[model samples]
Target: MTITVFTNARLLDLQGGTLTAPSAVLVEGDRISGIGATDGFPEGAKVIDLAGKTLMPGLIDCHFHVVAYSLDLWANAIAPDSLAGLRAAKVMSGLLDAGFTTIRDLGGADLGLVRGVEEGLIDGPDLVICGKGLSMTGGHTDLRQRTDVRPRCPWLAPRQHGRSG
Candidate 1:
C-alpha cells in the first residue's frame, strides 16, 4: 500500500477539547494506520510537513441540497440535468476543500452523483442522499414562480410506479 506520513501537526481532539503537541500521522493508502511522534513512520513512507498546522477530523454537513446550484429555484428547476450535475460537482469539490468529508443531501441529489463520488469520478465527500424530498403540488419542492404557470419538472417530482402525479 502507498504509505504517507504527516509530521509536525497539532492534532485537534474535539471530544477531549485539546490540541496535541507536534506529532506524526501515518497513513497507509486510504486509511490512517497510526498517530504519534515521528519515530513511528514506516520506512520509505512519503512525508509531509504540516509546519505546526492543526490536523483535525473532517467536518460533516447533516443537510444539503447538492443539486440546487443556486438560491434561484426557478433557475435550478430549468437547468438541464447535465448542467446541474456539473454544478453539483463543483459544489462538492468546494465542500471537500473546506474540510467537509461527509454530507447528507436531503433533497435534489440522485444515484448518479453518488456513483460518481464512489467511483472517484467526482472530487467530493461521502454523500448520503434520500434521492428526493416529498412535497405537495404547491409546496417546497415546486420551483415554479408565482406568476409563471408551467408544469412541475418531471425529474424533481417523485414518481409513483409508471407515472408522475
Candidate 2:
C-alpha cells in the first residue's frame, strides 16, 4: 500500500471548531488513515511538507447552477441539452477548482456530468443534481416572446406552452 504523509498542516478541529496546531496527516490511497504529531511514520512513506499551511476537509456548496450562461433566459432555454451539458461539466470543474468537493446543482445538470466525474474523465465536483428547474406561470424563468411557443411539460409553466396564466 502506498502512503503519503502531509506534514506541517494546521488542520481544522471539528470538536472545538477551530484550527488545530501544525501536525501530520497520513493518507493511504483515498482515505485518511491517521493524523497526529510527526513521531511515528512508517518507512517508505512519501512525505510532503505543507510549509505550515492550512489543510482541512473540502467544502460543499449547497446551491450551484451549472447552466444559464447568459442573462438571456430564452436563449439559454433554447440551447441544445448537449451543449448545456458540456457547459455544465466545465462549470462543475470550476467549482472543484474553487475547493468545492461536492455541489448540489439546482438546475440543468444531468447524469452524464455525474458519470464523467465518477469515471475521472472530467475533473469536477461531486454532482448532486436536480434534473431541471421548473417555474410557475409568469415566474422567474418564463422568458418567452409573445410570438414564441414552447412545449409544456407537466411541471413547466403555462407560458412554456403559450398559455398565459
Candidate 3:
C-alpha cells in the first residue's frame, strides 16, 4: 500500500487537552496508519510539510435542510424536483469543502442524495437524512404570506393546516 507522511505540524490531543510539538502523521493509502512523532516509516513515502499548522478532524452539522435552496419557502416549494436536487448537490459540495464531514438533514432530503454522496457523484457531507418534515399551513414550514390565497402549496397540501377550532 502507498504511504504518505505529514511532518512539521502540531497535533491536537483532546483527550488530555494537549498540543504536540512538530509531530508527524503517517498515512497509508486512504487511512492514517500512524500518528505522533513518526519517521523512517518506509521507502518512497510522500511527505507533506505542514509548516507548524494544526491538523484536526472535520466538523459535523447536527441539523440541516439541503433541499431548501431559497430563504423564500414558496420559491423552493414550487421548484421542480430536479432543479431542487441540483441546487442541493451544489450546497452539499460546499458543505463538504467547508469541512462538514457529517450532517443530519432534518427535512427535504431523500435517499437519492445519499446515494449520490456515497457513489462520489457529488462531494458532500455524510447525510443522516430524516426525510420530509411534517408541515401545516400557517405552521413553521409554511411560507405563505397573509394575502396569499388558500392552498399554500400543493406539495405540502394546505388541507393539512392546523386549526384552532
Candidate 4:
C-alpha cells in the first residue's frame, strides 16, 4: 500500500469541537489509516510537513444544481448542452478547491458526470445526481414563461409526436 505521512499539522476535530496541536496523519493509499504522532510509521513512507497549517475534513454540499451554470433561467435553458456540461466541470473543480469532497445534485447532472468523477476524468468531488430534473407542468423547475410558446430547449429531441417546433 502506498503510504503518506503528513506531519506538523493542526488537525480540526469537528465532533469534539477542538483544534488539535501539531500532529501527524498517516494515509494508506486513499484512506486515512491513523492520526497521531509520527512514531512507528513504516520506513520509506513519503512524508510532507504541513508547516503548522490546519488540516480539516472535507466539506459536503447537500443541495447543488450542477447544470445551473447561471442564475438566469433563460440563460441556462438557452445554453448548449456541451457548454453547460463544460461549465459544470468548472464548477466542480471550484468546489473541490474549496474543500468540498461530496455534492448532491438535485437536477440536470447526468450519469456521465458521475462516471467522470468515478473514473477520475474530472477533478471534482463525489457526485450524487438525480439523472434529470423533475418538475410539475408549471412548477419551479419549469423554465417556461407565461408569454413564451416555444419548446423548452433547442437541443432536446422532438416531442412524442415527432414535432420539432
Candidate 5:
C-alpha cells in the first residue's frame, strides 16, 4: 500500500497537553498509519511539509439542530419534508466549515434528512437524528393551535372527542 507522510508539523497533543515541534504523521489511504518524526519515514513514500502548522483531529459538535427558525418555532415543528431536508443541507455545510465534522441532532429531524446526507443527495453534517420529540398536549412543542395564539389541548377543545384530565 502507498503511504503519504506529513512532516514539520506542530502537533497539539490534547491528551498529553503538549505542543510538539517538528512532528510527523503517516496516512495510508484515508486513515492515519502512524505519527512521530520524519527520521522513521518509510522509503519511497510521498511527503508533505506542514511548515510548522498545528495538526489536530477534526472537531465534533454533540448537540445540533438542523431545522430551526428564529421567530416561528411552531412553524418549524410542522415543516414539510422537502423544506426540512433543504434546511438540513444548508446547516450541515456551515457546521462543517466551522470545523465540526460530526454532530448529534437532538430534535426536529427525520430519517430522510440523515439518509440524504449519507447518500450524497445533500451536503450536510454527519447526523444522528432523533426522529421526533415527545411533548404533552399544549406542551412546549405542541403545534395544534394557530401560529398567532397559544395551543389548546385537543382533549380540552370543545369539538374534541377524547378524554381529558
Candidate 6:
C-alpha cells in the first residue's frame, strides 16, 4: 500500500491541547494511516513538507438551512421549482467550500434535494435533511398568504393531512 506523509505541521488536537513544533502525518489513500514524528515515515513514501501549517480534521455544521435562507422561507416554499433547486445546490457548494464537509439541514428542504446531493447530480455538501419541518398552524410557519403566489400548499405546517380536519 502506498503511503503519503505530511511533515513539519502543527496539529490542533481538540480533545487534548495543541501540538507544538513540526509533526508528521500519514495517509494511506482516503484514510489516515498514522500521525507522529517525521522519524516514523516509511522509506520511499511521498513526503509533503507542510512547513508548519496547522492541520485539523474537516469541519462539520450540524445545523444549516440548505434550501432556503432564514428570512426567505416563505418565498422558497411558494416556488420550489428548478430555480429553487439550483439555488439550493449553489448554497450547498458554498457550505462545502467553507470547510463544512457535512451538514444537517434543519428545514425547508425536500427529499428530492437530499437525493440530488447524495446521487452527485449536483456539486454540494454531504446533506442530512429532515425532509420538512413540522409546525403548528398560525403558530410558527403559517403560509396562508402566499397561496396565490404558488399553488402547492406547505406540506409540513400543521393542518388536516387526510380527509377530515
Output the number of the TM-score-best candidate: 4
Candidate lDDT scores, in order, read 0.89, 0.83, 0.87, 0.87, 0.77, 0.77
- TM-score for each of the candidates: 0.78, 0.77, 0.76, 0.81, 0.71, 0.71
Error of 2 at 34 (Å): 1.6
- The ten-residue window of minimal lDDT in model 4 covers 154-163
- What residue pairs clash in candidate 6, if any at all? none
Which structure is stronger by lDDT: 1 or 6? 1
- Pairs that collide in candidate 2 are none
Over 86-125, each residue of candidate 3 has an lDDT whose tens digit, in order, gives 9999999999888899999998999999999999998898
Q: Which residues of candidate 1, in runs, are more than 4 Å off?
A: 136-139, 144-165
Model 3's lDDT to the true fold?
A: 0.87
Candidate 3 similarity to native, TM-score: 0.76
Which candidate has the highest lDDT of all?
Answer: 1
Q: Which stretches of candidate 2 lie over 4 Å from their true place?
A: 14-17, 145-165
lDDT of 1 by residue, 1-165 (tens): 899999998997779999988999989999998999777677899999999999877999999989889898778878999999999999999999999999999988999998999999999999999987878767878665668877767987976787555
lDDT of 4 by residue, 93-125 (tens): 999999999999988888888888899888899
How good is model 1 by TM-score? Answer: 0.78
How much is the lDDT of residue 115 in candidate 2? 93
Residue pairs with colliding backbones in model 5 are: none
Cα lDDT tens digits, model 5, 108-156, are 7778877887898877667787767678867766666646575655877
Candidate 6, 142: how far from true, in Å? 2.5
